[model samples]
Target chain A: MTTTLALLVDLAAIVLLIAGISMFRAPQRARLGNLVAALALTVAVVLVLRRHNVTGLPLVLTGVAAGTILGWIVAVRVTMIQIPAMIAFQHGAGGVAAFLIAFVELTRSAGALTPVTRFSGILGLAIGAATFSASMVASGKLAAKLRSAPVSLRFHNGWLWLCAAFIVGAGIALLLEPASGAPAYAAGIIIVAAAAGILFSIRVGGADMPVLISFLNATAGLAAAFCGVTLENRLLIAFGAVVAASGSVLTLVMCRAMNRDLLKVFAGFTPAAAPAGAAPEHHEPKSPGVPPEDPFLAAVDALKEAESVIIVPGYGMALAKAQFKVVELAGLLERQGKQVRFAIHPVAGRMPGHMHVLLAEADLDYEQIFDMADINGDFASTDAVLVVGACDVVNPAAMTVEGCPISGMPILLAHEAKRVIVCNLDSRPGYSGVENPLYESEKAVLLWGDASDSVSQLVTRVGGEA
Target chain B: MLDLAIMLAVLVCSFIIGYLLISRVPPLLHTPLMSMTNAVSAVTVIGALLLFAVETTGLEKALGVFALITATFNLVGGFTITDRMLRLFRSDEHHQ
Candidate 1:
């Protein structure tokens, strides 16, 4: 009877995991899926604990209660704009957990651990340590606590390889001589792995953060799976494998969207030169003497005459907290019998689908939002393109600039519209540091202000006219 | 050795299945997808709990407790955040 009950619980856990995976694939079912996953996970944990006949139930419950409270507070209090950072923190927490579990296991029975378990334990510790530290850096960058620019030491790549070699050597020594101060060796491995994580993440600039976060998440999952191996926990193996695979796929998808080589990203290579055909001199300033047009009046005029408008939102919009005002302007235009739609770049905001969340928060019609592939063909016939706090995604440099970091990457064809009105705080280059040629086009006018304030001004003027 | 092989097989198979499934998720749902995965990875708590169940030194027990705390934090935080984010995307039909 006991065996039967355990089997049933295991079956239920697998079913729940499968359900959670399937639900995540479809947006319409994601909410219910999260709930189901949470429930299923809770049940599984309880069953596992009961089957194991853990003695310290009170202690376990206390730890869980405290953690759940902390997690709940963070999840509930964090704004949509901070979701990326929150995810980073969660990944960090998971990493720390995996590392601790493996550390305890190794310390408890280093001599008894089979060679395979020892090897897997070392792998788990190294990965978990790296994920923890790297994710902390990612969280700090996303939260603006650290500079978003890439930070690198001299010969950082060499340092990374050296660190890897050191860990491998130490791991082998631990396996061969398990009794000779194993704890000290494990601690050394953790420290070196943490340094590697820092070195790896600090060299990546803010622009590539989404991919970095996903990649680190996959590493964390792999570490947990290794922990499962060390403990012979089937559920841990299943969950970890699923996350590792999903996270890696997401990383690849993000990299593909930007036309970036995954290997280059891992090697921390930044493209520093303009493409050969593009006018290198014209990169920064096409005409310094020509001040941008009176942005407010220009935007108002364009909206007045436009029959259709496409709004391109980027990280700047998120920084300015301007999605609501942007939606207001869209609604105003829609009321004027003009068709207004959002053109979403795959990597538009700090995280994937950031713009969609902001716009969705404002209760915009879902039909009005279109991804790059879905709406790229509509730009040519559009009456006006409103570039809202977006720079590199709509920059024409991607097309004409060769050898540029973002060259050949797909971008919204904002220049093809009858008129382009850009709303940004300044003419400074975007995260890639490549100057945007679209800003200098004859048909483009720059609106200078915080995105929210400028959009609010446009809404007032447009509403008055209506 | 046999158990290790079975575990490896499960890991590899589940990873492939996960990759195929997650690839189908629309870009619109990427954020929620990430958060959901975060929640699922919290399964490490099971390992921690099992560790504490067996006889262990004081240091091991302490480490197990710490692991339990962190894993639970990720599991609870990840799910709640995903659910909160997904709530924003629900259509008007569901809101009423």
Candidate 2:
């Protein structure tokens, strides 16, 4: 009962701390706070066990503290973008931890090991090890260290059968002799399984890792839940369930975002390679019709002529840290008797609603921002479309290219605007690694520069501060 | 049990909200956000590792060692990649 009480207090304190910290920092700093909160909560849980005089309490605390400090040291020193890979790494750790716990539980329960025990343990072990390998490859792919490509065997279905035979044989042997004490065989099985995971993950490149990562995360959670059931631990059961459900949902959403059926992706499906005679249905940019007018003067002209101007914020806006500047520009534009609204695209950044959060940080009014469907129609009627650091999403190719990776993806049809002013740093293509034909479109005028500087200039031009 | 249910519900809801919000965010923030979340997850592993290490039971001791290994991977692997990514921007002289 004392242990329980300690856990309860720890849980409460940790929760309060995490919530409090989130209110202060952006996502980057919030993560650090989260780690601290987790450690505190663990201490609380450990305190509960201490009251029971649990013999392993000290060892446990030491392990947890060392691991946490190591993780913290790495996290603080690392760059912001590697967070996803970091997340994957954590998931991998969780998977291994869960696997080990389950293995220990199985051995403890069945001193001589029943077939059922061995089977279940081996299954969990295989999945956990495989998940670890898959996630590691995913991290590498995200980090761009290893090439992401599916390895295909020429002329033989035999290797796959051989792999299957080895796995099944190992399972049978382990089940037959649950107390085999043969770490070599067990190690070999896990190694082979991990190799399979690595090969499979590397094979499917160009697809996002979120889905695979989510799936792996779910596997890890399930392993933990399985351990909880084995050990009759309620807390582990609860936490594991939460992780599993959340991971599954995330996987589903990622699949939907990419417009691929989850099953097809799992089956290693790719749209048939572009067929011969398929003249890529490309849009030729309208002749660099007339070079764009000076954006500085245009900003003044826009405020003078327009009663309402909408500012569409995209990923480029975030990359340039121009949210604050955009806000200032909006304020100036409003002062000059014009209204400003931000057009937000779904999938604007790498994650969802990324632009909205950045804008919110800049203290922009949420209601003033509009979705793509709601604001796309207004482009033709509006005075100008000030596109900052956006390319592929605003391109028309997404709708036209049938089998292209982002072909079926929904995008804002900014090319339909009357006067399109694009704020891009250069002529580089987007995530798809293809040139954007939108830049060459007739209605488009590329105002090349950094997002923040360009927006600041626009603001200064409007406020006559320049 | 009730507390567990509540926690589960909160996690699910937060994940959904985060997932939806992901689409609207800029790609540049994705790595940063991911790195941060990774750190959050690592804490749990750390806690597990600490709990496992001093366990009197053979089972608990084994579990602790397992947790330590996993947590180490997450900490080292994640931070190393993140640092490399951040280096890309740091080398740029004009990055704000």
Candidate 3:
């Protein structure tokens, strides 16, 4: 195949991949379509390459096909809660691809290298390889395929600095003899980098995985792009660029969610643990004033009085897989001649659009879901807020608590509703792992059950009354 | 070699972008979104490990080893955290 054509095919694949990722926040059908678009684009590119006679290993091709198929199935069958694992797997694949391509090029031209090229190659190879390893470990951790623990060795910073110094020294030595013994020196750097990455990750609490994983993903993509640069391949460069950009964006988002500086988190650091004897003792939310009403009963009342109702959901809703039940209850309420709209916080579920995916599963119309900013104003005018499994995001604590784990983080204002009906089993802190104050607010009521069952039962109860 | 450096830059940039994007999503999407990305990065294991056997330059071999090690740690650590987080969903076990 002509170089231009191959480049075009590769570019198309990259574009499709980006589009698919972007649409992940859209409805399931839309997400599925986007994913299919990416797969089709990839297949088209592969076919074009094949026609041009750019051959790939049978194993690579097979793996791609298998991955695509499996991804499609998961995309269709799995809930949004499962989407993070899938994304992690894809990042790993992209990282591996970049690492391998670089390796192939390096081995094929091992004996011949200018000082600069050798230096760049070693740097690229080390970073790419390190990123790949880190990404894989992160994937396992996020997917629940591995355990998450803070691996803290004594004087970790000192060891890390020592390793860094060693790598720099090795790197300089390689520069002196670029063509002959540089790779051996480069190997030492890679080992140190890997150790540093592991050690750094181990010190962070599990809550920070989202941000850490995203940063690692970006590293993997950058590694691949570096390989492309060494090989002077434009397509790899472009694709790698896209991956890196997307990962960076994700990392930024995670950082914002946690309200932390990206650099601080990456510097092998951890926040001071809740000081000994300082963490507020866990206490049952002393329901203030009148007890909060049952979400089901509240829904029935809302159906009876309101012309428009907006349902707000958070991570709690996703955990319960209550989207279908939410739909059922919504339908029953609509049948009572009231309008029902779902208010989805941007980061509402577990990944992105967790509520949207769940609602989509229940087969609701895409138009019915409302963005938080778009729907927040309507809460006061509405009759109820049927909160499910969510705690931290919907809890007013983010804005109310000064030094809480989730302080200053943006949250859904479920507390703003005239009647707040929470379908939670009990009080528990959220991703930031802090207690929720919303439960004690004057307007809130804890429905007390599995979100799915509660919503379904509410549907039945409301239907019977109707 | 030069190409490799550029690719590395791209990877780092994309990761930063990914992090930024996560900030905007609601809490519901945080976990699943993370898990999905975890899966994507997990693929690095296969990609990095294969390079070990590919008779690359000594530098390439070292890079491959580094990739494998990091990938192993990230994948394992990520899953463990995920499982722990998921325990929140078992509403029956926790609250009275």
Candidate 4:
């Protein structure tokens, strides 16, 4: 094929891919968009095969076959809450591919590459290696295989700087060293960069995981782009660039939603202020002026009487595996001819938009869910707010408390509703360690137990009432 | 030099277009969006394939296969899973 034709084909594939992503703005169009993007990739791959003089066809087929089988098995079986971990693991795999390709190209070239390509190869090596390691850590945490709290060392920022200095120094060394010395320096860069990746990710904890995962998504794409530059492949370069951009947008969106800057998240800025796992078991043990009433019965009575209701869910709901019951209860309420909508905080899940996907898996009507911004105003007018397995997101203290850990963090105005019912594991302060004042309010009823059981009860009670 | 310029242009232009296109995607589809883009990043498989275009040393061949397998795994897994996730949204359109 002619060079102009190849470039044109590359552009065509990229345009198709962009079209696929653009369709994601609508829920109904996204599935078709995904297929279009896959077709674009298939076309790109076929073009590469036709244009290049590829050898060892059987070997290549073996690798592709193995990968496809493994991927198919995992993809078919993995559940919704595991999506973050699974995506992180895949990013690690991409990282491995990127770094290995970069390393092989650098070592095999023997100085044949141009200066820019050579620099790109070194960059790909560093980023790919780091992304691999960091993604592993992130995947482990998301999967609950590793501790979710930020693990900070003494002088953690200083260690990060050292990691940076070493990566830069090694990059220069690879550029300057004799071609014979390339392997040793490349290995050094990989090792240090991997360490840097771990260090960079380990300081981000719990709720901050969405940002860490998104950032790793960007680095993984960046590594691929650099690998493309070294190989001088337009298709690869364009695809990688677009993925990198998408990841960057998600990362920033996650950062902004949480009211945090990217630096403080990755920098371990306030480890002492909120030791992640150190949340108090319960917020307010005393009911200052109490009615001797059962919270569950009160919740049932409240739900039965309310004409309009909103449900707020947090990560704890996912942990309790209560999504099905939660959705079931929503259906019951809807069938009762009540106005029911779900309010989802952007930071509610382990990753961005996770709660929506989790609830979607339970087959809830997509129209019933609303973003926090879109539904925060509705809380005041709603007759009842049901908070399931959540704490911080519904905490009225975020808006009212001065200089508190969660102060200024956007929360669902669940507190604004005429009545509030909390179904949680306990009266615990959430990950933020801030005492929620919602539990003490006169309108609030607390049902402390496993979320699935509590939600199922609500489903049963709501159904019986109907 | 011309080749380098073309490659750079592709990267920059694609990035800006991607940013413009993806920024409009609702948070409802963000997970699938990430999954699909991640699959796109697996395009490093091209670089992996190039390694086999020429005769390779034993070490090089091993690394080449490793890269190929992981890249393809990322690609297949990412796209298939994204398709599944996106279907959730599509199927919901029929519901009340």
Candidate 5:
């Protein structure tokens, strides 16, 4: 194929990819967008296979077949809650491909490589290996295979910098020498960068995970782009750079939603644990007169009377796996002629847009869900607020408390409702470790137990009322 | 040098376009958006395939196999899963 033709083909594939992303502007068009993007990739891969005088065709086919079956099986079978871990694992897989390809190109050839190629090769090696290890950590945390909280080692940032210095030194040595044992230097840099990635990721935990995961997504793309530079493939470079851009946009959006500093989180700053015995001991919400009896009965009464209801969900609801019951409860309320809606905080679940996926899995209508920005105002006028296994996003302390970890974070303003019923595990502070003033509000009713049971109770009781 | 310049231009243009396009995606689709991009970056499978085009050492071939497998896995899994997630987001209007 002529160079011009190859370039045109590559450009067409890229434009298709961009078109796919553009259709994501609306959920209705987004699936078609996904299919278009897949087609673009399929075209790129087929083009490469056709253009190259590819030897070892059987071996390549075997590899492709193996990968396809594995990927398709997992994608088909894995549940919504597993998506975060699965996505993180795929990021690691991308990393593995990038570094291995870069490593092969760098080490398999003699000293005839151009400086730019050599530099990008080294970058691909370091970034890909690092992204691989860091993504493993993120996936484990997301999957509950590892500690979900930040695991801060002593001198974490110091060790990270030491690894960085070692990679730079090894990088310079490889760039300058081009001698025997260059492969050794390349391997050393990969190892150090891999360790640095773990150190970088371990300090980030809880609500910061979405940011960390997407940033790894960005780095994985960067490594692929560098590998493309090593191979001088413009199509590969364009694809990698586009993915990097998408990841960066998501990372920035997640950080902005949380009102957190990206640099500070990356700098190994886990918030210090709260002091002993100073948390919300008296936060037992003063539920409006219940005749000193059942809070469940009282909460049920509040739900029955409300004309407009907004349900607020957090990570806790996901943990309890109560989305189905919650959805049923929403249906019951809507049946009672109550206008029901879901208010989702951007940073609500383990990943960006996770709660939406979860609620969608429960067959809840997308129209009933509202982003925090869109629905925060409705909470004030809504006749009732049903908070199921959520705390900090609804915690008034983000707005009222000073100098806490989540002090300045924007919240759902669930406390603004005339009557609030909390179906939670306990009145303990959320991931932020800040006392929830919402719990102490006179209008709030706390149903302290598992949310699935509480929501089911409401569903059954509301069924009777219906 | 011209090849290098062209490659850089491609990279920068794609980045600018991707950033602009992705920033417009609603938070409703961010998860699928991310997974789709993850699949796209696996375009490094091109680099991996090129390794097999030339005569290669055993170590290089082994690395090629690993790269080919993993990159394909990421690419396929990402797109397929993104499809599944985005399918869940369709409103009743589509079915009608």
Candidate 6:
């Protein structure tokens, strides 16, 4: 009877897991699926504990209660702007948990573990430790607590390859003699893996962060799955595999979006801007075209006459926390019978899908948002293009300039619109450190100020004019 | 050996299914999908509980306790955040 009950519980958990993952594919039912998955997981935990006859129930409950409260506090306090950092931190937490379990399993077994267990245990320790430390660095960069640019050692790739080779060697040593000096080998693996993680992440600049974060997330999942093998648990293995696979797919998608080679990213090779001597003028605003106008009046005038408007938002908007204002501006335009749509660049914000989260938070209709491919063609026919806190993505340098850092990177054709209005704080270059030629285009006008203030002012002025 | 083989097969099959399913999720929901996957990855709680259940040394027990806490934190925090984000994605019409 006990065995039957345990099997039934496992079966139920598996069903819920399948259902929950499937539901995520359907946006309308995602909330319900998430709830079901969470509840089912909790039930599985209780059943597993009961079946195993775990002692110290009070202590376990206390740990769980404390953790839940801490997690809940973080989830509640974090804003849309901080979601990328928050995601990195969560991955770090999961990595730490996996590392802890793998460590305990290895030490307690004391060289008596089977070959498979030893192999998986070492794999888990290495990946878990790397994921934990590397994610912390990634989180720091995203949150602006650390340098956003790539920081690397003199021989960054050399160090990465050396560390990886050492880890593999240690794993083989442990496999050959699981019972001898096992703890020493495991500790060495952890240290080297952590170093590798830092090296890997620090060399990746802001532009490639989405891909880096997704890749680390997948590594963390693989660590947990390996931990499952060491512990002989089917559920952990299944879910971990799911995370690993999905994360890999997401990584591929992010790479494609950036037009980067996946292997090059892992090798710490990002495209660098060619010698500035060849294109010195690309760094300065050569033509201030139509003298910068009163942003509010200019924006109001443009919207008043616009039959269709496209709003392009970027990391600056996220920094200023102006998504709601942009949405309000779009809403106002819609009411005026001006067709307004959002043009989202794949790498617009600090993280993947960052703009989508910000826009979604502002309660805008999803149908009004379009990706670069879907909406790039519409810009030429659109009456006005409002470039909000975005520079590089709308910069025409990617097409016209040779050997530029962002050359060949697909960007929105904001220049093709009848009238282009760019709202940014200053004429500073974008993350790629290249001046946007679109800023100097005769059809473009710069609106310099904080994104939120500029948008709010434009909203008030446009409303009054209407 | 046979048990290990079976486990490997399950891992491979589940991974393929997961990849296919997650690929179908719209790009607009990638953030929520990421958070949800993080929550589900907390399945390590099973291992932690097992460690606590088996008779073990004091050091091992402490490690097990720590693992349990971290895993629980990830699971609860991940789900709550995912739900909150998903709520923001619903059309206001649906909310009303």
Instruction: List each candidate's DockQ score.
Output: 0.72, 0.15, 0.11, 0.78, 0.82, 0.70
Evaluate model 2 with DockQ and give the value: 0.15
lDDT of each: 0.84, 0.56, 0.57, 0.87, 0.86, 0.82
lDDT of 4 by residue, A19-116 (tens): 88898998988889999999988888998898899888898899989888888899999888899999999999999999999999888886678778
Q: Candidate 3: lDDT of A461? A: 76
What is candidate 6's CA lDDT for residue A428?
74
The sequence of per-residue lDDT tens digits that candidate 1 reaches over residues A1-466 is 2355654566678678778778865567888888887877887787776667787778878988888898888889998888888899889998999989888877777766788888899999999999999999999999999997888789998999999999999898888888878888888999999999999999888888878988977988999999988887777887898899988988988898889978777676564644567664434433322454566787789899999999999988989999999999998899999999999999888777778888888878766889899999999999999988898899888899887888888999998999988888677777777878777677887786698998999999999977
Q: Which residue pairs does candidate 6 place in steric collision?
A: A111-A179
Looking only at chain B, model 1 earns a TM-score of 0.90
User: What does candidate 5's lDDT look like per residue over A1-466, in tens digits?
Assistant: 4378788888999999999999989888888998999899888888888888889988888888888888899889989989999999999999999999888877766476788899999999999999999999999999999888888888887898899999999988888876777899989988998998898888888667889988988999899999988888888899999999989998998888878889976765445365666555554544443433888777888988899999998888898899999999998889889999999988888888888899988988888889888998778899899998888788787788787888788889888899999898877778777767777777888887888888888888878876
What ordering of candidates by DockQ runs from best to worst? Answer: 5, 4, 1, 6, 2, 3
- Could you give me the TM-score of model 1 versus the true structure? 0.94
- Give candidate 1 misplaced runs (Cα > 4 Å): A1-11, A269-293, B93-96
lDDT (0-100) at residue B26 of candidate 4? Answer: 87
Across residues B1-96, which tens digit of lDDT does each residue of candidate 5 receive?
888999999999999999999999888787888888888888888888888988987778778988899988898889999988987774665568
Of candidates 4 and 3, the better by lDDT: 4
Q: How many residue pairs clash in each candidate?
A: 1, 41, 138, 1, 0, 1
lDDT of 4: 0.87
The TM-score of predicted model 5 comes to 0.96
Ranking by TM-score: 5, 4, 1, 6, 3, 2
Worst 10 residues of 2 chain A by lDDT: A20-29
Window of ten residues with lowest summed lDDT in model 5 chain A: A283-292
Best by DockQ: 5
Worst 10 residues of 1 chain B by lDDT: B87-96
